[model samples]
Target: MNKKTFLGIAALLAVMVILSAYGHKLERGSDNVISLHKLHTLAQKGEQLTWSDFENYPFEDIGSGLYIRKYEVEGGSHLLLSGGNINLAPMSINLVKTSGERIDIRYEEIRG
Candidate 1:
């Protein structure tokens, strides 16, 4: 190829490389399972869920023995809490999508 053509090709490659790097950051998630953007979205929506954006980490289930979900978010984990009661048997939570970009979370747990 001509010298000019080679230079153009090199510049294009550089631009592609930069775009790829930025794109990777957008898709990056904790343990490569979640997307950083998604985490941010969840946070903005006040969703309490363990967020491991920078590093790939797993959400730890803090057993029912302790009502510790509140502590998780404070410790850098995204804890998404919803409408649920602790003093109940077989406590569980269900997330409902009310509309676009909206979610309703219900929390239920068994309490002695």
Candidate 2:
């Protein structure tokens, strides 16, 4: 009832909400930002997605059959997706992870 007691309860609720959001990072995730590592495993397993899957989330062209959304995760990165044609409607997906400096290279060059 007092100011101190009310503040304590509010603080506790805030922490719980943050923790709950973090726990669901593997799903569609909170604020549209999913864990990059979790998505990597799916990509490795040949999982794919379409723009419709995101309910038409806004994305900017990143070139090379790729596009990226505004949502950011840890290390200041955004979710990236492939801009493939009809045959590849289920586009390949990835989320950028910026550790430090970036290496400018083609996907195949680095992947190969």
Candidate 3:
């Protein structure tokens, strides 16, 4: 191949590499959601759960056993619950979805 053609190919390859890296970074920075029911079940079953369990969905404990899991995705955010009263059961919580940044979950123990 001629020198000009070789240089053109090399430049194209470099652009592809840079674009690939940027795409990967964007994917990693995207937000995520977790199953609240699964979380509660795990805690009730004597399983030790941590922030790492939620995979890409990182969370922050905002006092009173409440947690906030933030995601960058838009719409269709919700929480699921199963058997037993959430307010009175171990690892019970009210998963509340609010606008922007993070989803709020209120967790408290209730005695019957």
Candidate 4:
């Protein structure tokens, strides 16, 4: 066994690992997809939204104004705003992407 042989084996293993992971992801499938921007807009309307409102995605309220939503596909954009007060307070807006199936949103004011 030489260094060349060891390197070749290592490369082959790496490729196999990558392919396996990708195959697993594909098997998971994507049937529930959501757009964060649309969610944000609906949230702003102050009309308590529910999982049924979405197409196929179901969201779970994890607690503390935090919500977890899952999607089957990715590639969406959203803007999130957080502040102590709506008119005057420290606020932050984040532009995020739906690169994965899992999405987390927070509604500090809206609670159950």
Candidate 5:
């Protein structure tokens, strides 16, 4: 397989594993599961999202044409990359898409 394809698949798998592993804790009842674009309103104020805060957020960004799927949770967040360029700096992972839109995630775990 091509390197890009491999990396993309690997990244997607990694995200899926992380979500399927500890995402069952939230009290959304029956496994909230990756619910996206459907969110007309985001979480309440001051939620701990690595990066979900958006101004004039495009509905598509939620999950429409996504290849990976962006998820903002407490301990960590996950983003789907549609062949976007990723920038790694400090403690954050930022993926910039061809459209110039950016998605970021941080590598950290919250023990609560």
Candidate 6:
């Protein structure tokens, strides 16, 4: 085949690979970034998290009565988490960049 034909095939393959990778990322998403509305509903249903509800402990703390206290979610430039006295673990949040700003929060919970 000619050089031009080879280059065309190579470019098409590259585009296909890029699109496939992006599709996977869209499906997997981040670590534990749930919708704020869903989180609010969970809290309303008596689920305690690190961001909003501080009165309740939803997860155990090192096998103790308390399970989860604080959590953090990291993306690209956005940092969403509870920065207070309560802490389950130490993490850095990095917010991703897009056409518009998309905020996603992460948290850690103790499960037995």
**Best model number under lDDT:** 2
Candidate 4, residues 1-112: lDDT per residue as tens digits? Answer: 9999999999999999999977765764653344544555545634344334443443333224533333322345533444344343213333345442223333333211
Stretches of candidate 1 above 4 Å error? 29-112
How would you encode candidate 2's per-residue C-alpha lDDT over 82-102 as one tens digit per residue?
A: 554634553445544464433
lDDT per residue as tens, model 1, 1-112:
9999999999999999999977775664334333334444543433233322213433345656543232122223343332234343222222212222222222232111
lDDT scores of the candidates, listed in order: 0.39, 0.48, 0.44, 0.45, 0.38, 0.39
Q: Name the regions of candidate 6 deviating beyond 4 angstroms.
A: 29-112
Clashes of each: 16, 0, 0, 2, 2, 15
Screening candidate 5 with a backbone cut-off below 3 angstroms (N, C-alpha, C), the clashing residue pairs are 68-80, 69-80
Candidate 1 lDDT at 2 equals: 100
lDDT of 1: 0.39
Instruction: Tell me how candidate 5 scores on lDDT.
Output: 0.38
Taking all chains together, each candidate's TM-score versus the true structure is 0.29, 0.35, 0.30, 0.33, 0.23, 0.31
Candidate 6 structure lDDT: 0.39
Top TM-score hit: 2
RMSD per prediction, one decimal? Answer: 14.6, 9.3, 11.1, 11.8, 15.5, 13.7
**Model 5 CA deviation exceeding 4 Å by range:** 27-112
TM-score of 6: 0.31
Which is superior by TM-score, 2 or 5?
2
Deviation from native of the Cα of residue 87 in model 1, angstroms = 42
